[model samples]
Target: MEDCLRIAVAQIPVTTDARANGREIRAAMRAAAGAGARLIQFPEGAASGYPSGAAKAMLAGWAVDWAALREELEEIAALAAELSLWTVVGSSHALTAPNRPHNSLYVISDTGRLVARYDKRLLSFSELADWYAPGAEPLVFEVDGFRFGCALCIEIQFPEIFVEYARLGIDCLLLSSFSRDPMFAIQVQGHAACNAYWIGFAVPAQCGDAASSGLAGPDGRWIAQAPQAATRLLS
Candidate 1:
């Protein structure tokens, strides 16, 4: 364990194609590793795009290929091991038939092992009604002596979640979202300031127009940010 750590927050374009999305994610991981980052966080649903409106209809109508998605995840895991980088990537987790899948963040260790998973508990109305199954518990892990917590989009509105993470003694919060709201940036910074912990806010490149992916310091200032609407890594 070291006294400091270098992390990368990615802003990548997400699409309906799982393989295409996986390719972008892998590219970012390599870039992060090349930049000397030990850990990298990605946007919400980085592996499986967050479907909505027409996209939702398409997914619900047999557009999703779970097998392909699984293969992509395996490849990503292998790459993480090769690069010796820890990764937190958002994706959809399938369940037994007739039950909806969970919106989840798969935490891969530097050894390329699927160490843990954080499922999104507080889902949007549409997510609950149609898209995903709610998760049951909060997730926390440690790397290089720093404790980290995980949270997903929409969960930002819940103060309790942040407070709980603070109580759990996390040194940083890894929050991923697919939203394009400007307030998300402000709220994430506020969370870091309030908790006196760092926060990596990872959003899709498309949403960068409103709020690009960034690392917020405990002082509520942006330490690093990816260019607006661009696919890049904030190291």
Candidate 2:
């Protein structure tokens, strides 16, 4: 078990096109490898693109191609194998008839295997309550002797989740979000300091008003951040 770990925060452009998004993810993974990062984290809905209220309304009648989404995920996992890096990426998970899809984080190991998955437990009443079903369990995974926990988007507003992870003895907390508010950074830093854990926060580059993707130390200081409005990898 290693005491030190290097992770990357990927701030990539997300679009409605899953193919294009997959390509972007692949590019970021290559960049992360060059930077010697063992793991990379992407923003919420990095695979299928996050839908805004208006976009969700428009897509209400459209059919979701789960097969295509799975193919994209497989490609990402393959890239992880090629680069020998772990990845945490956000996407939608399909469920049975009548039930809404889940907003989930897919954890891919360096061996090109789909490892544990973390579904977002907290669904925002204003934004996702109607579209996504809430998940119940917490997700914790170990790498390099460090335990990592997962959360998504607006869930950062709730401190209980972080507290639970702290109690579980996680060394790092991963947050994949689509929020464009400045408060995103503040909340992340606060949580990291309050829990004495590192925080990896990822958000889309093109998200208006969104904070840049980056990693924060347990001291509540930012270790690195991608340039605002640019698709890049920050290690």
Compared with the true structure, all predictions reach lDDT values of 0.92, 0.87
* Residue 124 C-alpha lDDT in model 1: 96
Residue-by-residue lDDT tens digits, candidate 2, 141-224: 998788999999999999999999999999999999987888999899999999999999999878634688889999999988
**TM-score of predicted structure 2:** 0.95
The number of residue pairs in model 1 that clash at the backbone is 0
Residue-level lDDT of model 1, residues 1-235, one tens digit each, is: 7999999999998887899999999999999999999999998889988885347767763356789899999999999999999999999898898889899999999999999999999999988988899999999999999999999999999999999999999999999999999999999999999999999999988889999999999999999988888888988
**What is the model-wide C-alpha lDDT for candidate 2?**
0.87
- All candidates: CA RMSD (Å): 1.1, 1.5
Clash pairs, candidate 1, are none
**TM-score of candidate 1 versus the correct structure, residues matched by position:** 0.97
Q: Which model scores highest in TM-score?
A: 1
Model 2: CA > 4 A from native: 126-129
TM-score of each: 0.97, 0.95
